[model samples]
Target chain A: MKRNPWRDIRLHGTVLVLVVIAELIGTIKIPITQDVAITIMPLIYTIILGLAFYLIKPIKWIHRKQARIAEGAMMLFIGVLIAKLAVSSGQSIGLIFEMGPALILQELGHLATILVLPIALLLGFKKEAIGMTNSIGREPNVAVVVDKYGFNSPESRGVFAIFIIGTVIGTIFISFLVTFSLSFLPLHPYAFAMASGVGSASMNAAAIGPTLAAFPGLETQIEAFAGFSNLLSFCVGIYIVIFVALPLTEKIYNWLEPKIGRESIMPKKEDEEDA
Target chain B: MPDLIDGSENVSVHGIMNWIFLLAIFSIITVIGNYLGYHHPMESSIVGMAILSLITLAGVWLERYLPFNISSILYISVIGIILAFPGMPTSEFVLHYVSQIELLSIVTVFLAYVGIGMGKSWDEFKALGWRAVVITVLVIAATYYGAAIVAHIVLVLTGVPAA
Candidate 1:
């Protein structure tokens, strides 16, 4: 299909429209505790954009390659905001140190995903399913899995499955989970803010949204912490997956393959061959 | 140096024009959003948008020139931070105005694009079958609680009271 340039313009321009609408809703105060009411803006604009994207179905014009470029460019400005937050954060060096244990713990939590491998194995998932569920289902995981296991490997299938899921629902899940935890947990909001970063920008934003809304005063510190944590995860996460996460899953798979007695856990021929 | 200039000369006018157009639209959205949301004066909002545009442009170009696979977002973020750091000459204006820039709007738009991208890949996602659903659940469980557990322990150790 020949792409329409005007539609391309609107597609890219949608963000601008949503920004205006979000400005109109402004912010709302939520009572989290006595003497502390966190004011969070209702995400009306996001909900509206989501509804329009699905119902209106404006999924034409911009080619995939072009969209990727546009997304990358949009993210660049977001990054600038993050950097600004970081600079603001640096002024309060005490908060940085005060938040250290929380940051490290969260990174460890991100790394703790290795636990999923054994669970998958014990659940009778084929050897191939181990790699996919064990690491984050992001782009880099896709690359690493394809590189080591080959594109057609059972491992690749597992990775692809999780990647789709993560792409579609991961941010929403993270956002909700963090918000729910905040109401019940006794931790400082800063801890949740750092934990919110978790590598993916969208996921970071989603998780941080409630936290920022809850403590609008700390937006800069929270954004900066999340950005920093995300950078750390991105920089170190790939290596962890390649050297530790993937390899460890492989070892666990080998050990559990015997216990399952080579039962055909794979449902399809392609998965069997890949295995 | 001569080779670099030759390469720069080969840059297409269409690409640069597209970039400029995108930047203009972004600036317009930002200025209007700032004026409406924060109730800032229109003049200040325009000034703020101009500064943001320049910084963003520099960031886009820097990403192209810089080596390695670092994200453009990180590059732009560093540039914004350095230029607007607390004692810098432009710190006051940049900090005061940039802070007014609405983040959730960009986030919402970004996610919407992501959704569209996912919709494009719908067929591929469907092909993964049921196991994909199971894997997704497990991955979410591990990640969400994994981070939460760590935070819980650390906070408790630090003597922070639970809510």
Candidate 2:
């Protein structure tokens, strides 16, 4: 059956309703300590509520097809968000140029993903460690893995697992992490804003939302820094993943697999059997 | 691999039409959200969203027609920067209206779609078991903090005061 585009009306309508409700509720701050509070934004609420409505079996409000449509629409909608942020970058181009080194160098922090490999190997992840720890395993990263190794390869499976996990909870996780870090970290808000551009649009937005709320007076600068940093990440990220991250991951996997690697919990692949 | 990797789509007439349709829906919802959440005037919000959508479409056009392979977002960002850069003819007007639409308001609408889309993947999410979940948390923390620490150091080195 040919998919009718109008069927998406249901998904769009639901999101429209959810947005209105979320905006009305506004930002909520829950006190976690004397000096720290977790700031929950309207975006966070809509995501949770939209997920609940979709998952509720009784109503069948969203079909699998509609959900899939929503996913495609999401890719396009992110462009609008990028355009919005890019304009900020343009308006504040002078400030961005002044902070150019910080903006450029902070992306190296993505290399910190390797910090998790030894743990993954110790937990007996095998070749899967390369895919999971090489990067945050967003769509492009997954594609690189799948292209190098076939889709059925262990590395592909590793990348897919991270991609799925990222799609599901990455925004929430990043937001909370940003909020928590803001509470105690002695960093400047601009630094935090630059760090918040983690390559993924939704995740970047999630990270920036909290940082903006925490430092209300610095909104323009924060937006400009985060937006430019994110754009930089998006443009340069794939090359880094393929050249630097993937090769580095393989080397780490080789060196550490013998030192602390445990027996594999996953079944052995055919390639491994021959070896 | 696929279009997702190269960032190129079919760009057929039907595809372009669908994009326009979806963008219209997004703009309407965003205008409503901007009004309710940030109290931006609805008229300005509408104009703001229209400008954004036009920029997005132009970026898409460039992505499809440009000889080099590049993501649409890159084009969109460059176009936005040029249009809004200081002393540009469009800078004042573009910034005036676009700024009216709050970043968080656009985010709220975008993530709602993300959330609804996520429902289909719940079973796959659950099947990943505890180990993947653990690694996901650890990796996120490591990347975020690692980058923040590096940026903080750079900023401090450059004579920017810490908060």
Candidate 3:
């Protein structure tokens, strides 16, 4: 029956105000070529605002809590805006339907562990190292790993390591990759957008932003597909990691580790346990 | 004497007021966004906010009633689909104005919040050291290119136009 403090209106109101200013700043554009131009871009400024709140003493002291509070407040809008996009996407239902296979296939990208784990093993990474970098590092991935492997397992360190990397730089990395790939690839933007939503909000933003820049007309469909696909990723991602991705990685590791020779930078788990 | 106001759990003045406050802010910001970004009529932005606010509220209440929790995004998304159904009344208007909503600009707010959230974890990151960095880079590249390759193949096979 107790009220939640995070729901305080003053805190949410402050975030909304700051976000409006940031949005205005991000919306401003400058022409670069006959057809192309550059702009402030929202994600860039948002990160700056976040960094400022995080690093600056006064701002961190005064606004850090509000910034955190604002994060939750803004989540409400994400659904609303995505819904608005879905409404606009009705015209493209046929296209979305046709692209269903592509959307699901694209989501496989989030199962990074399946592909990366074997390679990490082949490259002389310790057996424990493979599990850490294999899956798309997100909130739930940690839970699944801890549950399956136990918190003290050598692999847990890998999960924690990648989890931090995923948290700190994942969004920016995904955004840049999306933008860069678009420059050369013949892939559809919707496919990329759906791929971006692989259960991480910032990564979704990074993926959607560049595609939005490239193909403005398809914005609604792209947003809708990405949003829906993200929801799917969130709902099913844990199971995928626990069952499909993890099992597949283990099989690959079992096959490759013997061939690669198990020399590794990390101390051997068996040796550590023995000591 | 009959009770002037019924004491029911469903009736919440505070909830209504909160939604109104949010709706007002959303409408004002949407107007500014339209001016700076989409250039839609001011009236459309206001109307769009009102409609969206209502949809959000409905989604919230719907979630409360559902046997299992459904995400608000999906709930509102279903509402959006029904509203935008072909030949439905106001479907055209909903289509026109929803397009004018600056979703990307709004997304910036979420990303900023995420950054702030990440910043709060500076110590944990510092402690993880460089191994995490290498792993992160590889994981990101692996996921992105892996997905991109699949997408590219699908697009090529479906003939949906390649980059």
Candidate 4:
């Protein structure tokens, strides 16, 4: 069915209500220690509330079709958020350029994904680990995996699993991660800001909100670094996944799977099942 | 919605119009959030929303019509940079109003939609099982920390003052 935004008034109205309620609650700080605190922003609350509304079965507030529409709308809304972040990036493009090497090199941090392969293999993930560990499994990354391995391939399943996990709790996890890192890590807030740009719009937004709250008065610079780095990830991320991440993942998987690979938890292949 | 990942789906004029309509609604919600959360004035927030919506629309249009294949985000960022670049004629005006709309407010609305949309995927999420969850968390942490650690090292090496 063609999406009719007008018909999805309930979804939009629900979002509006969530936004208002979330904002009203405002930023809350939970002190974990003398110097450490986890800052929960309105964005996190809004997501939790929205999720509650959708997941709670009794209410049946958001139908399946409506949920799908909301998902589509979320994708569209990202464009607007990107615009806002882009403007921030534009305002301080010069400063961003000044920090050029740091900004660009930080992206290599994406390679850290490979660090999880041994753990995944030990955990019994097999071929799936390639898809799951090669990238962060954002939409584009998922598409790349799907494109190469076919949608039903174990690799696609691996990527899809991470993609689903990302879609469901990525923002919350990232927000908390940023706050937690800020609390303990001795890194500069600017470096944290640059790291917040993990190539996913919602995750980037979630990551930056806490960073901005953690460090007052550097909002513009934080936004600029996060936005520009995210933009770089978005533009160049796919190619890296294809040329660098995938091939490297395959190589590592071949080398590591034999050494530490366990019986796969994933369902056996159809051929094996028939055999 | 269009196939944003592959760029195979052509963005129609009809689709753009729908985006504008949705963006207008998003702007109103964000303005309300900005005022209530950050105590920014509604008038300025509204103006900020308008400017952002315009920039987003222009970027979307360019993405659709431009001969080269490029993400709307890149176009939007370029347009935003051009408008807000130092000494640009419109820079001051653009910054003055748009700055009032807190990035968090926009994020709240965006994530709210994401949360609601997630209902359809809940079963899929559950079916992925505990191992996926564990791995996903580790992967996310690995990527974020890896990036932060790298950036921190470079910044220190380059003599950029820490914030």
Give the candidate number with the greatest TM-score: 2
lDDT of 2 by residue, B1-163 (tens): 2332221122212367787888899999999988999899999899999999999888877887899877777788789889999999999999999989887788789778767766765554344467887788887787788778898889989887644
Over A1-275, each residue of candidate 4 has an lDDT whose tens digit, in order, gives 34456456887888888988888888776654433344566777886788789889887657655565665565556566766666666676675566679998888889899999999999988788999999888755754675466434567668867866776677778877887888898898889999999988778877887788889999999999998888767645655777788899999999989999998675433321100
Model 4 C-alpha RMSD to native: 7.8
- Candidate 3 ranges with C-alpha deviation above 4 Å: A1-17, A20-24, A27-40, A60-68, A98-275, B1-16, B37-40, B112-122, B125-136, B151-163
In candidate 2, list every pair of residues with a backbone clash: none
Tens digit per residue, CA lDDT, model 2, A1-275: 34445345778899999999999999776654433344566877887887788899885667655665665676677678778867877886675566668887887888999989998987778887888898887655654565466434567667767765775677778877888889988787888998888877677877887898889888998998888787666545655776798899999889989999988767433322100
Q: Count the clashes in each prediction.
A: 3, 0, 6, 0
Instruction: Calculate candidate 2's fnat.
Output: 0.66
**Candidates 1 onward: DockQ, in order:** 0.21, 0.37, 0.23, 0.37
List TM-scores of chain B, every candidate: 0.61, 0.77, 0.63, 0.77
**The TM-score obtained for chain B of candidate 3 when compared with the true chain B:** 0.63
Candidate 3, A200-253: lDDT as tens digits: 666666577777778877888878877876655654455466557877777777
**What is the full ranking by lDDT, best candidate first?**
4, 2, 3, 1
Query: Weakest 10 consecutive residues, lDDT, candidate 4 chain A?
Result: A266-275
Across B1-163, the per-residue lDDT of candidate 3 in tens digits comes to 1121112222221354555565456556556655555566777766776777677777766766788756555577668777877777968888776666665544454454445544544443354466557667778777777766776678678777533
| Candidate 1 chain A weakest lDDT stretch, 10 residues | A266-275
Error of 4 at A93 (Å): 1.4
Candidate 2 positional error at A6, Å:
4.5
Show model 2 residue runs off by greater than 4 Å: A1-3, A100-104, A117-275, B1-14, B148-163
